[model samples]
Every structure is written in C-alpha cells, then in structure tokens.
Target chain A: MRTLVGNHGWATIAAPGNTGNVADFLVCRLIGSIFICFSAILSGCHAPLSANNSSRVEITYWRTLTGAAGEGQEELVRRFNNSQNEIHVHCEFQGSYSDLAAKLFTAAAAGAGPDVTQLGTFEILQFARAGLLVDLKPYFAGPEAINTKDWPGTISTAGEVEDGLYWLPFNVTVPVLYYNEDAFNAAGLLGPPTTWDDFYLYARKLTVRDDNGVVREAGVALWNITWPLISAIWSEGGKLTTRDYGHITLDDPVVLKVMTEFQTLVREGAALLPDEASGGHRAAFKNGRAAMILDSPAAFQEIFAQAIGFTPMVAAYPAGKNGKVYAPGGGGLVLWAKNPATNRAAAWRFLRFMLSAESLAYYSQQTGYAAFTESAQQVMTNDLKDSRFGVIHDGLRFVRGDFSINMSPSVRNAFDEAFQKIMVDLADVKTTLMEADAKAEHAIAERGI
Target chain B: MTRTSLKACGIRRRPRCIASQWRSNRSEWLTFGAFVAPNLVLFVTFTYWPIVYSLHLSFLEWDLIEPSAVWAGLGNYARILNNPQVWRVASNTLIYAASVVIVAQFLAFFLALLLNLKLRGQTIFRTLAFTPYIATTAAAALVWVLLLDSKLGPFSFIFARLGVEGPQWLARSGLALVAIILVGIWREIAFATVFFVAGLQGLPPECYEAAALDGATRRTMLWRLTVPLMSPVIFFLNVSGFIAAIKMFDIVAIMTKGGPVYPASSTYVYHLYKLAFRDFEAGAASAFAVLFLMVILVATIAQFRAGQKWVHYE
Candidate 1:
C-alpha cells in the first residue's frame, strides 16, 4: 500500500511499511531545493567573469552627466574604445554628483568600485584625504602622458592636495548673468550692468508693477544657492574661507555688506527668491517672470530652450569694487587607487583620451561647459564667437579654484541658513552672520575638518 | 503493551513511547526547518545585521570610506543633543506626524462612513479616493508644486480673483511646512480610508439593530456600537499611521527639501540622511538611526499598552 500526504500542493509518497525512510527522503529533497534556489539567486548578483572571452583588459568608467552631455561623454568613450584594441572600456551613467559620490563611498568600503569616476569639487578633497584616489603624477611621464600645460593653471592645480594630483578637470563652468533683452530694452538700459552699483539701479528700473502695486515682473531672481553667491561675495572683496580651510570668514565686513545689499534687493521687491520646488531661479528667468538671474553657463541650453517669446542673453557678472574674481564650478575625473596596475594604466589612457583637445572641444560644443584647456579653446574658435559662450569664457580669466570653506558641509549648512534668514526672513545681517560664524567654527572644531 | 499496562509501568515504558513519538514527528520538524531556513537567512542578513552594524557604527568616528573606524564612544550622540538645529528638526517631525495622523484619520473615517452608505457609483468613489495612495509619490509632489506656485498656480488665480495674492506656499518657512503636511495628509487619507472601509464592511449589523431597539440614535449607535466593534482596526491604523508619518521623507525631499531655510520643514529622518550622505558623518547618522529606533520602539510599546483599554479583539 502507498499513502500520500500533502500541504500547499507539496506532496510526498509514504511506503505503508517504511514511513520513516519516506520522511527522510522528503526532508532531504526539501532542503536540497532550498539550496538550489539560494545558489541561483546569489549567482545572479554579479555578471559572469570575463564572459566575452577576450584578451583585452576590461575597465569600468562611471560618469555623472545626463541628456546631451551624457551622450557626448558616451561618444568620446566609444571613440576611445574604437581607437584601441588592447583596452575595452565600459562606461556607465551614475545619477547626479551626489548620487555618484554615495555609490563610490559604499563601493570603496566594500573593496569594490569603478576603475574611474567623475568626481565633483566637493568630493575630491575628502576622497583624496582618505587616500581613495590615485596620484596621477607617476602616469604623467608615460607614453600617453597629457600636456598639463595645455590645461588652465588654476583648474589643473585645484586638484593638487598634499603634493598629489588626484583629479583632472573634465567639465568646467562659471557664473554668468542671464537677462531678458526685451526687459532691458523696455527699461531703457543698454547692455548689461558693468558695476554692482549700476546693477542695483538696473534692477529697480527693470522691475514692473501692476495698478495695485503687485510685482508682475521681478527685476532679478537670485539663485539662492551657495555657488552663485560665491561670486557676489568675492566681488565685494570677501573671502568665504582661507586657503587652508582653517578659518570661516563669513562674518567679514565685506560679506556683511554684500549680503545686506542682496537683502535690500529682495526686501524692496526688486528680486525674486524662488525655491527649488517653484522651478528655482532658472525657471523664473526662463518664464520671463524675472528679468535677470545669476546662474552658471551650464544652464544656457535649458534656459534658452525654455525661454520662448524672449531673446534670452548672457553677460559677465557685474564687477564689484575689487574687480572680477569668480569661483570655478563643475566636476573632474579621478582614477580610483584600488585597481590593479594594468587596469589603472588602461583607465589612465581612457582619461587622457577624454581630456584630449579635440574631445574637450567637442564636449564643450555639445554641452555649455567651458573648454578648460587652451588647446580646446583654440579648437573651438568659431563656437567661442557666440557672445553667450564667449561671456562664459571671459569669466574663466579670473577664476579662483581654491578649496574654500564652503567645501565643508558644516560650514556650508551654517552659511546657507544664515543666507536664508537674511534674504527671506529679513533678519539683521550682522547678527545673523556672526551667529553663523560661531556655529560653523564650533562644528568645524568638533568635526576636525 | 496495552495503555493501562504502560501506565502501570510508566517509568520503563516512557523512553520507548518518546522514541516512537520522535520517530513519527521527526519528518515534520525537518520539513518545517527546511521551509523556514531561507526566510531566516534573509531576515538575518538584510534586516538584523544592518541594525546591529548601525548600532556598532554609532560608537565610532568614521567617514564611511576610511579603512578603519576610530573610537568615539558617545561623542556623536552628544553632538546631536547639543546642536540647536536638532531641536527644531525634532519639533518639525512631531508636528508633521501629529498633523498627518489626526487629520488623515478623521477625514478617512468620515469618507468611509459616507461610502458605506449604498450610494450610486460607490465603486468609482472608492477607486477615486484611493488613487492618490497608489499614485507615485514623487509625481504627486511635482503636481502639488505647480498647484501651489504663488504666481502661476490655480490657487494664485483664485486669490487674484478675490483681490489678494496667494501666499508663497514653498518659499515661506511656516507655509512650507503646512504645504508638506497637507500633501502628507492627502496621500495618507487614501490608505486609511481603504482600511476603514474594510473594517466598516465587516462590522456586524446585529449590534446596530440591537442598539436601535434600545432607543439609540444613529450617532449613539455609531459611537457606542460601531466604534467599540471597530476598535481593532482603529488601533492598527493609529499605530501604523503614526509610524509611517514619523518617517515621512519623500514629499519633504521632493517638495521642500527641508528648506526655504534649514530645518524649516526637515524631519528627523531627512536630517539623518543629510548627516550621513551630505555631511559624511557616518557615526552621527548611525547614532541618529539608533535613537530613532528607540523612540519608535518605545512609542509602539506605549501604544500597545494603552490599546489594552480600548481595542476590542473579538
């Protein structure tokens, strides 16, 4: 006789005279199935090793650009791969800068990360200090050595920390004044403001009000982010931080003066401070709701595309009393130090290809990012003739790429809160700045940054 | 041996009887182990291990990329407690959770009552009411952003018709928090309503009829008969809703980003996220996680204790 027992469609046959043997068989089968499932799931976590069966060295390159710029980066990699048979590069798109940094940190902690990654200015210092990035000085003398002199001094040297060059500028940007020419024409203004004083006056003149005195068109819209505000502060002869990151000088008299003027602009209804959710300052400028905005040239493509019915134009940021000293913004490529020597060499070759003059020029033409190399700039002679791109390049002459205090998260958070209080809440500038300085100092001391 | 004879010789027969029982039940135990092994492994690997590791990390000074962690003891906790912004964040979290739970629960209960009535197009009403809950949160937040824009939003149009300007919903500190809370309530009401509808449907009609014979009005019947009978669902919703509200991050992240000013609309979890990811303060973030866990555990325990008096478990 045979007996069948089942639960949830799982069944086992039991011999009438030998039930114990049947039970053992059922148990063993069940356990074996579980192990099989577990093995399959774990196996799926990673790709089969070198499944391509090629002798070429495989390297992974993680990038943080999207849309047209992302496509440009992909094309550059494709060209590099086609140019060489010994190296096969797989380029992956990691989401935004912060997202890439987070993934890199986790991957590094686990002893696994991409061979090369595009790192932002904020991450280079921390990652370098932690000894996660490769020192490229050794690779500078190889057959694929890049001409460092062709790259801008400030930008190339910005990556140098503790006698090690860990980063190379890939995409560079600078803040420029974006304005509506029609609004300027209506206000009887010619060209962009040349001085901060003239800029304030132009803002007031360009502002339009309805019969009930409601502002229909704001004269200027402040980006309200730390990057653009750096220019205004520096133009006023203020320093956000010392070169060594030891002191946060946010409460200096020059900073107070600059911040006070910004507060006055917002308080007097000449400026609009739109938050990120309300499309930010870019959207305000694009929609013609605001006549002027200070933004990075990286926004040129999006702003122009969206600013329909208006002749959008770009100009150099207004000069302060001390003249034009602007901060350089954007990200750079850094090779991870954890890779094997062969992989590292291949990654270096890929980096050299990306930073080549032709590649840089092509990238800049495709994206609004400024070509940082002199050779790349020379290659793009005709593209630079456009006033919008030319104005962005003009700001590059006085770009300061030092690791300032704003690079520290604690200090940046403190300053951002202070800025919001002064600009949005109409708080007293002096007191707010002083409080922020103290808070930042305390946090810096505690964090030991 | 016969059962009476075995009982008389209990000590001698006990071992043989136990051996026979084990022989019969061994397969069942093995099968149970086989079924449970996979889930147990997963839970231990993913959930329990992370909790344990986070607790360990809370005592160290590490930036996450460093090869080794330095001993910090309670330094992370001390810094968190000393920071002034932390208190504001905690207050914001409390206000958000309380507002969402109280407002959403009441609105959900009211809608459930209306929907419980045999009204026309009830299925459509139920589906419409629950749509927001199923809709993607990030997408919904983007829509809310446009609807609340001070200059071009629909609300702005209405305010303009009344000879007034619409308040800057996301640009002002107080209004920003209110806007986030409103979105939270909107999404949460749908989930609570579905649960409430189910509970209402399952309620016994005999209780209400008995109350009516006892000269109870509809209001009294609802209060005395229905509420007690539905206490188990109510208890579940309250506990779960509060927990969900306290961890609210997506709407705040997408809509306000804890901004217009720092900590203006930031919640506890968002603050913790910034510390870990943005600030690179892994130890401090871990400490925050541990503290958050403790708070949740204590709050849940307190709720369960209080529920003994009100929750009906028939």
Candidate 2:
C-alpha cells in the first residue's frame, strides 16, 4: 500500500503490442544490444542494496503551488529527505487551488487520489463528509503529536469538522486596505480610514471633481470587492454561513445593510464599479484609476509591481460601531489519513517533516507566506517587519472560509453574484441578496457534502 | 401506406413476374444488410447506446462519488425548472449561440467570397485569415485575456488611451457574454471562411458570365446570382455552425468560468458542467442535458423544414 501510495500514478509501461517476425538486421541488433548492455552490468545476481528498506519509508505529497512557492515546497521536501534516512518524501505540484480541488474530487471518485494531499482549511468538512479524507483526530489524539496550543485559534478553527481536527491551516490571508499614498496626499487626506463611517467620509473627501463637474479623480474603489463586503457584514455581527455550515446566511439584515450602503456609495459616485463585463477588479486598481482597493496581503507583491506613480499602503479595515472587525481569508492545510494501519504512519511522518521549523522557514522565506507553527513563524519574524504584515493578522481575525467544501464554490458564487447585482444596479440590495440566499440554501440542501 | 408505398405503385409487373421479383428481393436484402452491417454496429455502439444510457441516467440522482445512481424520476428536471439559474443558463446559451452563429457565419461568408476572388497572394491572405481558427481556444483566450486584460493588457491600454474605459473583460457580468461571443467568433471565423471559400469555388462559372453578359454589376451579381447558388452549402454551414455554437464549452470555460453572476454569462452546457462537477448534481445535469438535446433536435427539424424553400442545390 505504501509502495502503491508512492507510485505517483505513472503508467507508461502498458503499451499494446503485437509479436511479429523481426527483420534480420533488427534481430542481430537486439542480440548485440543484450551483450553490450550486459558488459556494463555489475555481475551481481542479487540486486545491489543501495539502502535497506528499514532505513527509510517514502511518502507521496501532492501540493498546488508552482514557480517560487512550488520551488519552496520542493526545497522543504528536499530538506526533509536530507535530514534523515528514516523518511523520504516526494512533493508533486498538483495545480492551483480550484484546479487541485477539481482534480482531487475527480480522482477520489475514480479511486486514485493521493495519500497526503494539501487541502484548504474549509474543504476538510466537505471531504470528510464524502469520506474522501482520513480523519486526523486520532493522529492528534495519539501520543506521537505535538501540542496544538502553539497554533492560532482562528487558523485552526476552519480545519475542524464537527469537533474533529481535519487539516492544518497553511497560508491564511486577510483583506488589508491598500491605498495610494500619493492619491491620499493629493486629496489632502490625513490617513487611511479606521472605521466604516470614516471610510465613507474619506471616500467623499477623496473625491475631486473637475471644472466641468465631471470628476477626473475619484476616491477609494474596492477591487476584488466581494470579500470586503463580507468582512463588513461580519464586522456588523453577520455571518455568511451558519454554524453547522449547512446553509448560507446572506438574507440577514446585517449582510444586507452592508450591501445597501455599498450600493449607496456607488450611487453617490464614491466608488466606480468597474465593468465586470470587461474583466475584473484588479484592472481598476493597477491602472492608477482608483485611489484605494481592498485585497489580500499575499497581493502585496503584485500590487507593488503593478501600480504606477503611487505607493500602496496597507492598513487594517475600519472598526464598525460594535468595535467588530472581519477578515477575508483562507489557507491550505495539511491532513492525515484515517487508515492508521497504512497511510497514517506515512502521513504523520510526512506532516512532521513538512511542518518542521527549518523547513517552514525556507517555505515562508521563499513564498512570503506565513507559517502554521509558532516556531516556524519565529524563525522568520525578522523578515515579517513590512508594513503590509501589520494589519494582516487582524484582517484575518474574522476570515471565514467554511462553506462545507461541497457548497463553498456554489455558495461563494451566490454571494459574489449578489455583490455584483448590488454594484451593477441590476438587482437592489434586499431582493438580490434574498434571491442569492434562497439559491444558496437550495444548493446546500440539494447537494450535501 | 406511407409515401414510399405510394411511389412503389409506379412500377408495373405481371403475376408471373412476382416469383422472379421475390428472388431479386432476397438478393437485394442480403446485399443491403451486408453493406450496412458495419455502420449499423458503429451507430448502435457509439451513438444510440450512449444516448439511451444518458436518458436512463438522467432520471437518477448521483454524484460521481457514488458507485451506482439512485433513481429520481422527474425529480431532477423538476428541480431545474424550479431553479432560477437554469432559466438564466438557457437564455444565456441562446444569446451566445445565436450571436456566434449570425456574426461568425456572416463574417465567414463575406470573407470567403472576398478570398474566392482571383487576387494577388490569395493563399497568403487565406492563411492569414485562417491562422486564428486552427489555434486552440485555450491559447487564443489566453492571448485575448492579455490583450483585453483591463489591468496590464494591451487592448485595454489602447482602449484607455482612446478614452474608452473597457471593463474587466472576463470578470464582470455585463460584458462577459459579449467577450465570450467575440472569442467564439475569432475561434470560428477561420473554419467558416475556409468552408465558405470551398462553397464559392464549387459555384458554376456560367452564372457569373451570364450575369456579366446581362450587364449586372458585381454587387447585383453577388446578391442575385452567387448568393442564391450557394444557398444549399450556406444552409449546411448555418445548421452546423448553429449546432456548434449552441454546444460551445471551451471558449466559455477558458475565458469566464461562467462567473460574476449565476445567469449573467452562463450557458446550458456550462450549467450542466456546474451541476455535474461543482454542485455534484449529476442527475440534474443529465436531465438538463436531455432538455438541451431536445432543443438541438427541434432546431435541426426547424432548419430542415425552413431549408426546403431557401436551399437551392442548383
């Protein structure tokens, strides 16, 4: 089974063949090929024992990052491989996040998915429901585990399914406010908005109309704006999903109020809804066409490179009247196999290697991603001093990615749609959200994980 | 009897000729069966059986995870009817299909006619026009994404300079379908142009000469003579283009992922994909697929009926 798990599904040997008479020259070549090859072979009857079986056990790991992050994961695996001869781990780049999930679900259905694949914190519930994941509760409960106290509470929350630990939070993120310093200075504004009311006030203050009354320079425009609205709703004490993760909670007035206020902002010309029909949110920001946009800390690199004539400053989201805040976030988490007799041993071994302090530092340093372990994080704390890192954890404080992996894409789609409708004036706040809520509930009820 | 039986009465024979006719009939049956056996087997194995299986499976509810599908009767179809997204998907499919067919086919026809003319570097011109068609949709959409990309894309950059704020091409709902339509047209134009060119080449030369003798202008000749002559081929192209456009998946999949909204830029096939893979609604997807097949069937029938008056082989 371990050998099977480590095969990586390469099946090139199964070529269909027909045995026919060989040409005379080919037969001579074949005979010659055998003798020539044999000359270089060591004259040992038994296979040379390079390393004994007991020296190391191999585990196959599937991850979904490419380029630098991919290389980081690869380096981590290499370090793990080199650390000791007791365990050899291989890392395979499955695909991007959505692509990985699709491939995973498809393969699990086909009974050929990998043994210790990386899963999102929220996806654990869905996979667990489908019996696609091996339960990690027993692994953590067993004597061979480290203390869970070092892990952040919020980061670990999404990884649990019905009080059972499912996966580790890998790269969690929250939507920090990224504003143009030059734009703010030009508008004669003091600083980033620290409250929702202040956000509206600054957006109004930031608006500059030309002589002809057509505004040449506008205030803050939200890019990738849906998650921020969700954050606002959460700050107002609303949830996007229920505690059980069975149905969506979009119809709640707190959520609707957030959407309605956003609509009013569009009406007042504080924010420009970039024509989604054209492309998406990032385009609006990168062109220096907008003063401010809300995006993830992971986006710090891209925004810095893309934005021109302006330095983007990262800030915490506005604190609502309730002193509440929300985070727009998620992370890839590791999970162990349930089959303790076979994959569990391999999974635990692999997990330990992957989450090692030195390994995590190498991974974090390479990708600019946060580590799941406190020890791993401590090693890279000096490098985390950028202004962008300050508001991120607070932004991720209320980040929710739980939608029962089965209903997530669909439910999130509904929420995204509702947000679009709100911005585009196609559907108003109350009706659109209600419609979305109904659709999301129907999707959830109809398609259980 | 049916129309064939009535036509058979046109043959005249005596009673004694009946025995000889029976012997001929037996030979004809053997030869006909032998000739059709291979095709019949293929049709049954590939086309008919799968269709039957799809129909059977459509009435059952199951995700890909399940070992066997559980029967759901009309439940899947009922759910689709109730869901607002399904209606949106159907409408979107119609808009996408109709727009692609009309726009692509018109452009193809005109371009093909132009290419058919005896011109300098006609092969080069044809190749230049056709390169986009042979290119994979994924590659084409990617290039289009970069070109039309609102942020760093060149098309958007140019568009900005022109004072036209181009929306995010693949992200927003208002113009997503149009973006998809544009990509679909680009992907299809080459094939249409090639097919149209073939149709033009196959035209009888005498009609044009006759028109010339009658002092018909080139425009008049094209409208009165060439266009009518190419009706049969045009009809075939239209039907095929219509079908292909209706079933378009690759362009939509690569370009939009049927997003920003549920019904805004979605199509039936895209809906089917979501239902089956994303939502784990295989039974509903299959049922929707059946409805989609019905649509195509009806369209084909309508096309055949409409073709009789307009499609002139001569």
* Candidate lDDT values, in order: 0.85, 0.69
Worst 10 residues of 1 chain B by lDDT: B10-19
* CA displacement after TM-score superposition, residue A47 of candidate 1 (Å): 6.3
lDDT for B106 in candidate 1 is 91
Specify the highest-lDDT model's number.
1
True contacts kept of each: 0.62, 0.14
- Model 1, range A1-449, lDDT digits (tens) per residue? 14255443333345354556665676688778878987888887454336263778888899997877789899999999889788888889989898888888888777778888898887777788888999998888777789978665376777887799898888888878999999999999998998788888999999998877888889999877778778777887888777565878889998898888888989889998998988899899989989999888778788888896899999998888789878888888999976666688888888988999899999989889888888999999999999788888878887876645545766777888899998878899999999999988887787655
Error of 1 at A398 (Å): 1.4
Q: Give one digit per residue, the lDDT tens place, for model 2 in A215-334.
A: 445576765447667667667777677656565678888888777777777677677665443334455666676777766666666676777777778788777766645553545555
Q: What is the interface RMSD of candidate 1, in Å?
A: 2.2
lDDT of 2 by residue, B1-314 (tens): 65566569775444377677666455444445544655786799899997887788789987665556688999988988987778888888888878878888889889998898899999999999999988887888777767766656777667567665546666567777888888888867888888889888988888889889999999999899888988887888789988998888876776677765555777778778877776656677788889999999999999999999898876
Candidate 1: residue B211 lDDT (0-100): 81
lDDT of 1: 0.85
Off by over 4 Å in 2: A1-56, A207-218, A223-225, A245-249, A273-279, A334-341, A393-413, A441-449, B1-56, B66-69, B143-172, B210-220
Per-model TM-score versus the true fold? 0.93, 0.80
